[model samples]
Target: MDETLKDSKKLISDIQTQYTRLSKGQKLIAQYILNNYDKVAFMTACKLGETVGVSESTVVRFANALGYSGYPKLQAALQELIKNKLTTVQRVEMANDYSDENTILNKILKGDIDNIRETLEEIDGEAFQEAISRLLKARKIYILGMRTSFVVAQYLGFYLGIILDNVHTVRMDMGDAFEQIVRIGEDDVVIAFSFPRYSKKSFQLVKYAKEKGAHVISITDSLFAPIASESDNTLIVKSNMASFVDSLVPAMSVANALAVAVGMKEKEDIKEHFDDLEQMWDKYGMFE
Candidate 1:
């Protein structure tokens, strides 16, 4: 197996290339996986073995034969392969198969914790700093995120707006997302939030920003993500599948961190802005 070929899309090719040498038991596992990867990606090694009529050890051996360190790594690769491709119905089905109703809470919480840990470990510090630097220097910062990702984009835009005067949260509700960023230029920074089931509009927005000579910063789940290729700086954040919805806990943490980092560099300005806002709110009796 070519160790350099780690892309999830190539995993299938790798298996096919090595199929001639696989044992009968390994072949069964591979065949089942090749046929039902979306389901197998969420299955336990034991479950996969049972489905293929093989022993658990055979499944583990199959994974090793495919060049993964263990079954978990292979499973992750499978998940990565189908993450953006799974439909909502398929995601719900996969979640039901993987989680027991009696322990759904425990499994979900633990999974989210693991996602956060992985994101911390994998995040690029240089990219993070460069994103901050660009945000600080940008003549205008446009934030784009569609569907569920819009929530995180809104939060980031809100905080960045407070810290900096030139933040624009691209509102798809107003009109076309492209129209919102049509004026983007070399002095602009487009910070895009994209994850699995990635949006076409978000991808196009970033691509246009890059073409216009603007700095594009992508906060997404993988280096292999479409937006990453169009970005000046890419921040990888781990996101988990929570039934039909993609969990954004770690993505939100990254947004919060970016806002804080930018704020830290302009604390004096933030303090002044907040102080004036506090006075206005107090005068208007906005809060008890």
Candidate 2:
């Protein structure tokens, strides 16, 4: 890294450091980025130029002035700065601003569409396959999700439970976290979910699972996400913000895909489980 851009981690501070040296057009772009980096992170160079009323060339030049190779590097640094810091209240406010042109429903749905598109484009196929392999070989599998992510955990656990004989869903409640994870052993694997405004307890739980010798696989929004950073494997999911909600659509899609993969891997056993389950349902007249 160039000395001038070494403070990429300190985006705000670097902006301040370079303030006096920036041109008038650069100043405008710099100020907009500092004030609205969360929004800017997703903008294309052309979009960013439009937002700041500069040419795309100007935007690229501003990035070079900051000692970055190009606009993408600068934008990525901006993302890292705000990734875990944006609050739900802030997201709601952003949604309000973005929903002006479209109906709230359309606006929100479009955001989810973008999220799923981006997630699919960037998902690391190798890591995903490794995660499936880990799940298949583990002596037991523990699924964890906390707070907003609990739904994702339950979805994964319920589907995987039928495919794997030894599957457990570890609740995020502090009281239950330890009790559930205490017995995790070397041959076990833990699939954990965590997203923005990350839970400290989940972080602690993943760490504990690691200490207990479980192979940890994380499903999260970013590689920099605390849980993903510490895990042996991570599945990256794109989460969009819509009215203070972290869109779970992409996360759920990832869950369903993983479940199907695991099921196909254990098709013989799962077929038997389904057969028995079908009989039980028939016996109880459980269907509508």
Candidate 3:
């Protein structure tokens, strides 16, 4: 079991309580660290300051206000908190606190809840919005996911096609996808979903799309993913859970969010499309 930190949650909550008391520079540092905890947890004070558009002194001040000796101690504590809470492999496995049959349900629910919550907390809002915008504007949208992730890709493709035209879901057949890829142009976009133990084919497809000048957005679990290196924008969804099997809850949530954002972007079009479908269904007595 991981050693309990010295009231880390209380410390974080206290910092949050005094949020309004922070100076402008310190506030910037504080907000940045809170929003990007995963990144800041491992970063040095100078790197944290640079990333947040603040000075090193500002980072130190923010640390001191949080009741730490200095930035390093605060960073260490934050790292421990992150290591305990974040759904990464090493941290989550080490922190597993469940056993027995009744605890199985609790574990699953907690894992799903944690996955969604951490994903939302860790996501970069600007990046997410930008990805939605790109998908909305693209002439053709191609979605690729293999194995378990295929379900999310299919769901997105199905809903997105209802809202917008020219949405393609790439299947596992490499030849079929290759043929489809040839038709994609600079104005097109490809959304690829791949997590840890990522499919090589997904990486290849993303690379192929990039080479063909298609904007590629990747939804993945790690910065180390092969697809991430080739992706135009990567949305990280931390899906670390108990059991070696991956969970779909976080991926589905992200896909649903993307679908909603895309639908909202083309609200009128989606409305008209659904209206026509309803009319056609009634005319054919399809529901009766």
**Using lDDT as the measure, which candidate wins?**
1
Off by over 4 Å in 3: 1-101, 173-175, 285-288
The ten-residue window of minimal lDDT in model 3 covers: 1-10
Which one wins on TM-score? 1
TM-score of candidate 2 on Cα atoms, chains taken together: 0.85
TM-score of 1: 0.95
Q: lDDT by residue for model 3 over 102-136, one digit each (tens)?
A: 79788778889988997888777987988998987
The positional error of residue 79 in candidate 2, measured at the CA in angstroms, is 4.0
Q: Candidate 2's residue-wise lDDT over 163-211, tens digit each? A: 8879999875557788988899899999999988788888999999998
Candidate 2, residue 232: the lDDT equals: 94
Error in Å for residue 220 of model 3 = 0.6
Clashes of 1: 0
TM-score per candidate: 0.95, 0.85, 0.65
Q: Count steric clashes of candidate 3.
A: 0
